[model samples]
Target: MLTSSTFSYAIGLILQSIAARRTITSNSIERGLVIRLATDRCYAWGLAAQVAGFLLAFYARETLPVYLVQAAACAAVGVAAVMGAVAFGWRVTRAEAAVLAVLTVALVLLAGAAEPSRVTAVPPATGWVLTALLASCLALAPAAWRARGAVPLAGLAGAAFAVLAVASRPLPALDVTALPLQPLAWLTLAAAAVGQILLAAALQRGSTTSAGSAMDAVTMVAASAAGLALVGDRIADGRTAWLVVGLILVVAGVLAMARVGTVVGEPIRHTDNDVADQPITQGNAR
Candidate 1:
């Protein structure tokens, strides 16, 4: 479910962040090698989570509704929050906690309201669109690298990640072993793979807050909207109403959380060599 995947990502990110901080500080060739290895591991695990989540929904589409699966995946955000708190040693405020509770309830209600059906299979154009979009995102990585501010890098990364998420959605139908190949499926995989890599690299360049927020809030949501619209996915009657409301609540909650700056998504261990570009004190971690 989304809850489990969310928990998985939160933990993965926290671990990745911790490792990045250490490797960045040590600056040893060995450390660099280790960091690359860690990145690969994280990428593999993340890919698995994404694929599993999507396939679960696809396979179950016959029995369960689309909204239910998507909403369940949305629950992963909550898991991310919990893991973020633990990893960063941050405490949740009463208001934030209340917002999360409401979000959870809203998602659950939306899922329960869904209608199940077997929609038409994906078409070829989907492959071209995904490929082009992903290619575009990768092209932007150079700019993100040249950019100085954390915000710009984060923004570019967000866009790239959004493209990645969009590409990842149609993956369940891919048949890698088939003839010349399913160009569409391959395109989707390429986009998702490149997008996640770029997104992860973007996170490596700045604070966890900027990184995670860009990845989760900005990129993921934007991509989801694009997929729903472009892929011809429709929202069920009541669920459509709740989707709008749920989106509003999610945005408000994110903004409220953002007001309290600093990377609250992962922990940092201090060492003599470590330089604080933005020193987020313990008091501000929340």
Candidate 2:
């Protein structure tokens, strides 16, 4: 599930970057609309990939604590950062590289300290799960409405995704035939969709560093708490200190990466000679 989620997210980020580049290079209003249409296609592909990753993650949640799954999922940011650098000329500073390394080490420690999930054959109570999902969304609505910037929006998006993760716990076992019969599954889908929309909006409205970091921190904490309180997830015996340390390191590293702008590239400028050397195109001024 981790591998699948990582691969899918990587693909999604690549597509998103391509779409962004297309949007940047558009020369006129009509051409921009055409470019936007193409970009939408890329965005659709990216969204599909993200959805696939989330679904796999939901399944993994059945056997892993929400914190564990979420922490691992946060690695997607690192993946996306690398992708941006490779495909979009984004540069990673030395500090960002060190932070990424710290994040990797912390995740390893967290994984080692995690207890095996207590698997149950029976699904959780549907009514309470539904109520919780609804109530959480309603509660978060005010904050979402009041949010003023990308960081707040990203934080809200993280909270929404955290709710989605919790809602996924009671889902009927991975049978495609049983999905429609499960209300929790449907709720999970709705929560995921909402979260994705908010995340996209946040990305559009603000810097990836600020928005992404806020989202990551909120999601990690919310998911961890929900897992412990609602799903009966526990840390490995005698590993509480290590777990706490790992969590701190992971969160700090993620924030550091965000602050350093690892996932988005600095704007590139063309030199006069380079511009002059290019052949004239239809969009060029006479």
On TM-score, the leading prediction is 2
Q: TM-score for candidate 2, please give it.
A: 0.77
lDDT of each: 0.51, 0.66
Candidate 2: segments with Cα more than 4 A from true spot: 17-39, 118-147, 172-174, 267-286
TM-score of each: 0.69, 0.77
Q: Which RMSD does model 2 reach against the true structure?
A: 7.0
Q: Summarize candidate 1's per-residue lDDT along 91-154 as a digit string, tens digits.
A: 6566657656766775665555455444345566765665676666667666765664344445
lDDT of 2 by residue, 170-283 (tens): 562457787787666677777776676566655554555666678888888877777777767779888888788888987887788677754554553334332223321112
Q: Largest lDDT belongs to which candidate?
A: 2
Q: Given candidate 1, what's the lDDT at residue 127?
A: 56
